[model samples]
Target: MQIPRWPIATEREKELIDEVLASPHWGGFHEIVARFEAQFAAAHGCRFGISAANGTLTLELALLAAGIGPGDEVIVPAISFISTATAVSRVGAIPVFVDIEPYTFNMNPSRVQEAVSAKTRAVMPVHFGGPLVDMDRIADVAARRGLIVIEDAAHAHGSQWQGRPAGSFGLLSSFSFQNGKVMTAGEGGIVLTNDEALAAKMRSIANQGRRPDATHFHHFTLGTNFRITALQAAVLVAQLERLPAQIETRTANACKLLRLLEGVDGIRWQQVHPKINRNSWYLMLGRVEGGAGRDEFCRRLREAGVPCSPYYPHTLYQNPLYRSSPCRVTPCPNAEATIADAFWIPHNVLLGAGGLMEEVAEAVRRAILRG
Candidate 1:
């Protein structure tokens, strides 16, 4: 089957790039950056947006803005991109690793409650692979424990839970515009918040602590430069225009593929809750069944022309860097089991025609049978 290419650049992208190239202000202060920030935030039902150089820096900035400093602890999922845990360390806070739901690949809310401690100040739940975490449960825990909620929405561009957008449920939410993300500008990120004061603080931190109206080289607080370029923002603006339609296409294709795989042995797809109104479908996650090794299954699927991968071979705590990092760990059986079985089909494949989904299902069956 022919799979569609990702980060599809059209005439609109070219037009936007040209505009940024011709403009005098190519820096972060450019109007184009502000426009992209506003537009992207509004799309996710956020009141304000602050653009940054990269996704990791955005999380650090959010931590800083929230006053999560040394000795503070932040609860995080055991299975996620390294940044989810490292971001807490970068801000001088320890990450408390919690188990995930085997099927959803998101942090188990019950585990979150167990991980909380006197030092716990916040919870950072990642909407892993475009499916929103259980925000309702996370919120209830946070409210009772007096902990803040910061969403790691890097994989959930247009996902929603119970009709609420992914970024809107948390006190602060971060999004990545990395090359592989559903939205891409090569490298960029943003933070969204409903609180005007928090938004100003984040902007200041990303702008080297300069006050919004400062005309001189004045620094109010300790901050660093995590600014995004006008060029990247221009590209993001163009990409944003394509997001809604792309999300719809991906979701439709995912549904078709899931239906085709129904009752099929040797495979189990992610179990999305009914409350999840829309899933971004960044990657269609599935687990190998019938005793096939995850890597072998992925190898055979690739040979059969299926764009698949065995993602996250191990939990984040197992990484060498985490060996010395100040993080609290607990046994996460679900996360460990998922690492042994998870496989992913990239979102670009879902951009293909509905018939291509049949080809994908067939490829899966072939890979399993061959194994």
Candidate 2:
């Protein structure tokens, strides 16, 4: 059977689209967009939310709102998707690479502590795939050094740590509603923060820098048109409503698969933190062990009709963009190691019923045995 892939849009999404089309205001000016902004923000325990066209822009807008500019350095985990680094670059700031914890696939808090230079203005901690970073440790370090925390919660919607929502910890946090994310609107993002001033600044920067109450053609600061449409918001609101159930199914599937693969010697799963009350399970990550080839194992799994692939092939600092840019490039052996061996099962496949997860587990077992 063909395993389901990302963006499992349903009748609810279509109905929302129809509702949007029937309305007079279809762009960012509609009531749906306003309601989505408020509801999504409140759901995450943040007082305000600013919708954006994409997650990367959300990060850039947040940085800009936090006054991150040229010469300001933001510490970023080396193991994240390239957007984490690119967002810093887009804001004319430097991204200082910090090594990740190989098992958790998140930035090592000690390395973050060491990477903070005099020019450091912020620390962007990415909750890679389904797991959260050691926010407590990172927060302590940031507090000691007076650094702004901008969480990259692209993969962490509906995820909580120590009973607090993922996006609520940072001065600013960003979430993606891209096609493959935990919640999707085809393409959209939001920045959440309790700081009213920061939220207002981000909103202004996203909307061409007009004052929140301004009606005239007056530009208050440097900004761009990064606004998300009412249609995307409508779909996202529906997705948000469905997220809890989706997360539950994915978690159950992940656990079952983990149990089935317990005796496998050549594969290991990502370590979930004890404090992670919920995991959105955007990608079920595993590492190839014992010198086994990651590609070969993934090939076997795919041959068995279970889709799988290696995670990011390269650490962010290893990319040519960082090579050419004028930024501090640090050694991240942990990130390098993690990227070289990591493979992921897309969360969408786990959404299926009818013993699909058992099939995935059997596929991995057969692949490991063959290896």
Candidate 3:
């Protein structure tokens, strides 16, 4: 059987969706959405959760809620999804691209410090695939500089570092429930924060700038429609129930896959920071050394029925959107090289029990031979 690339919903998700559809409150106004927001926030050890239409918009909401806007500069990792930087730009702030650690594929804190300036307002650290950035280091740097820290935790669902969960580290953190993410709600996102003021702002911004006590027609600020429907929330509630087990399975399978590939030469595994206690394992990133081209390696893996592709084809700054937009663009040698050498295995493929991980290992060994 072909390994599935996206999440496969079970009967629970179907039943939840159906239940929501049968309810009198069918839209985002339903109580299920509130329950989902509360449950998701509590799970991540956050005081508040505000649902959004998608992760990208959630980032924008986070930025706006934090009072980051025009003429402000936000330090961002060069290696994350384009949404990370785009959100800053959408808030009318400049995104200063910081190079990543060559091995960890996460932001280099030193580079983040170097990128700071009088206009700098915040630092958005992304928890890349397997391990998170050193949050303590980043937090120290940001605290000293008086810069706000926002976490683009779209790839991290149940990940934790040093006993602290990923979403709890930053002033504001955003999660994606896109179909490809560890947890799926088809298309939804949520922002988390412990600060009650920021949480209230985020809620208002997501709901067309309407205040809780304001008149029905009275608008509070320039907000957009980013509310997530109750149906989506219901499905996510069911999906959340399975997340712990899914993460456990993925972590175990990843360990087995690592052991299997340990003897294989020329395949460099991504380094996991020691502080990471539980890795969500959004994907498994590896580099092909010994002068093997990443393209050829990915082709071989595909040929072996093991789907693999570059974590990102290019650094976020290299995208044409940034080139056209008036944002700070800088060269990140490490990120540039990383995009060229990276190849990843989808996390969902590890869901199957039995010899699936062994099959993955065998495929990697075969690919190396072809490389």
Candidate 4:
């Protein structure tokens, strides 16, 4: 049997929704939403939470709240998902592309300092592939340089760095609740911040730039109608309850595969930085060693009753947008190198059984030896 990347919801998800349907609260502004916001904020150790339409809006609003808009340059890692750069561009800010570390897949913090200049307004470091960035180092640099730090935490839910939660490190953090994430709201996202004023600005900015019940129903700061349905919040609340168990299972499964794949030739393993305690193992990446290539490796794994890919073969900067952006993609040489090298595999707990991950790892070991 093929191992699915994300299985259908367990019974708990349905039961939670049934309870929501039976209740009076449904919209995001309702009491249940507040409950979720409070619980999430408490979990992340943040002072305020503003749930938005999705991860894209989460960062977009965050940019606006952090006072980033036209002509300002927001430094972004080229290896991350496009939304990272788009969020900056959405607010009319120019995205200054930066490189990423080959092993950690997080932004190269040292290089980030070099990228900053007079036009630089904010540094948005993405915790790519569920690895935590060295936030303290990044923050110190931001402080000295007079820049805001925003975290694209789409992959790092429940991840920790030196006893601090991933979302708590940056000036503001963006989270995704799309179907594939650790916690899925079907379609949800949020921006968490310790800064109360910034949080308030994000809230109003995300909701069409109007204060709730303001005398001027007028849309004030050139905003979009980015609001998640109450149903999304209700569904997310259910997922949030199961998150601890899910993360535990995912982490364990990732460790199991990591150990199993170790000492195997041709499987380039991703290394976590020492400071990261709880890694949100969203996807496990493997590079074909020696003569074996990513395409062939993924193909063999798929044939072995495992849905191995949906590969992110290269960095997002190699994409045409950045290639043609007049700024040039070659500037971030390391980011381009890291992105061109690997393919992603299913990190699903279920994939461990059915000899899936083991089989895939074994196949790569064999292919590299034979080829």
Candidate 5:
């Protein structure tokens, strides 16, 4: 059972790249980059999109655009990639870490209320592994608390909740085109928003703080270069075209695998929310009974030719960098439990044929049996 290679490039990608290489403007000011930005934003149901250097910088740009600076705080999940919290810190604000849901491994909205402080300016919910955070609950909390919602939608390109797209739910949502993400451009990111003023601000900030129409070398605000080049955009445009089909395939394979694992003991799959109409299926997540058994289980699965690994072994607060950082931390039993038990199968494996999913399920069953 051979798995498909990731970041799959076809003739369309080559054609776009050739166009960019032949064009005079291969920089951020090219039409190719602008086109990709528009296409991605439209697909996610957003009014404006601003391209950036990478996902991390896009989060920082969103924070800065929202006026989140010193003396402010942002609520984030304890179980996300470090960038979710670090982006808040990069903008001179503190990140208040909250717990996540044990089953979904997403920010626990019930914990958001307790994490809110007088200094809290926004709530940045990450859609971990392509399953959306409970946006409806997160929105209600933010509204009552008067906090902005900035979605770290790095793992949620096509994910939707209650028929609404992931990038459209927040004041500003960020997406990554990193190599590991469902969509890839080698390295790139984009910010999506409906607010025209906020869009302009992020656009300017990403392009060295100059007005979009400015012809001269005049800096309007304190900003640095965090621009995406035409080359990356060219690849991303082709990738975006291929995304819908890929998402369908991944979802089908995920459903098949889940069905096959139904009677398997000691394994619990990530529970999808009732409201989630679509999941991007970036990774198929699950957990075993014991933390001690998790590693050996993964080792066994890999030996059986199923690509698997433990998901974030530690919560963000457990990192050494957080110890000296100016951030607030609350008890996160769910996050801790998730770190101990959860493992993941990469999205690329799901891109394989339906028969491959059967092999994956058999591998899981064997791993559990041996343990």
Candidate 6:
């Protein structure tokens, strides 16, 4: 009835995919993959880029290359997708989950100081909903403390803050080209970094650590198979060329909804960074000021043919994974508070994105009035 979730690829995407299928070499590990890597490096203002199987593995590879391993602790936002912390854990390191900014949903840079210890190795911040996490502040903290900043930029593509690109601030940045992202290769991702050594190490880790120029199956480091296919690369190359228009359209639709939802009594869209001229707008967040029926409000909007929904209806710390994890024995007050109140509505990429959002906002207004 309404626009489906995201990235309803255009005819341009269709044509390009067809061409890719017709080609003999369509894997991400092929020569064209290098082209895409080079393009992504240039786009992110990085010296080198390396493609990996998916967003999670790309992040893990980056952490490994950065020399984050056993006995190390990487501080992460408690409000983000689990992948952020899981990547840290996969390399035998502990994930020190810190609370997020109530408004930004990005890691609180100030909190990292409290979380840091002798074993603290890095800070991994997520760019929640496409706005750059106060990266300059994060970078300053990391530099002063001699810790690496690994950006889980899976939500941010082409997002910038104060003229510096989102991908440039971290020692290493991982971007997802997952189906729902702004720039997707369906199931592929990349790690970007200005450091040449880190970049090469990432490359080797993604490809089983085969030493360069020696094809005798020589292994340099213990690594895994996290390389993407040629087909995925072809899809990404095509998708990259069409991103500008798609981003403009999604931004326009998000603003339209923001205008309709603001001042609607209890509900409010999440705050944007003052430096953000553009909210790449991965999702449109709305927090209920004091509604007795926040969850039901969302349910009614969905039942009214609007298809809006809540994201992270409960906090991660409430889940079995974190509640029993050895890392945290105490409750994260900020994470619990934010997750209990914060929720999201859909931001579709279809031509009907604007109208769908307007209808959903109207539905929400009615539901709240009656709640």
Which is better, 2 or 6, measured by TM-score? 2
Which pairs clash inside model 2?
none
Residue range 147-180, candidate 6, lDDT tens digits: 9999999987777788677778888999998887
Ranking by TM-score: 5, 1, 2, 3, 6, 4
Task: Give lDDT per model, in order.
Answer: 0.91, 0.87, 0.87, 0.75, 0.91, 0.76
Instruction: Write the number of the candidate with greater TM-score, choosing between 3 and 5.
Output: 5
lDDT per residue (tens digit) for residues 1-371 in model 5? 68888879999999999999998999998899889999999999999999998999999999999999999999999998899999999889999999998889899998998888899999999999998998889989999999999999999999999989999999999998889999998898999999999999988778777996886498898778998999999999999999999999999888888899888997888888989989999988888876678888989999998889899869998999999988999899999888888999899999998489888888889898842
Better of 1 and 3 by lDDT: 1
Deviation in angstroms for 223 in model 3? 2.5
What local lDDT does model 1 show for residue 236? 96
TM-score per candidate, chains pooled: 0.98, 0.97, 0.96, 0.90, 0.98, 0.92
lDDT of 5: 0.91
Local distance difference test, candidate 4: 0.75
- Model 1 agreement with the true structure over 175-227: per-residue lDDT tens digits: 99999999999999999999999999998888888997886499997878999
Clashing pairs in 3: none
lDDT, residue 344, model 5: 92
Error of 5 at 263 (Å): 0.6
Q: Which has the better lDDT: candidate 1, or candidate 2?
A: 1
How many times do residue backbones clash in model 4?
3
Task: Rate residue 67 of model 2 by lDDT.
Answer: 89
Model 2 vs truth, CA RMSD: 1.3
Off by over 4 Å in 2: none
What TM value does model 1 have?
Answer: 0.98
For model 6, the run of ten residues with the poorest summed lDDT: 345-354
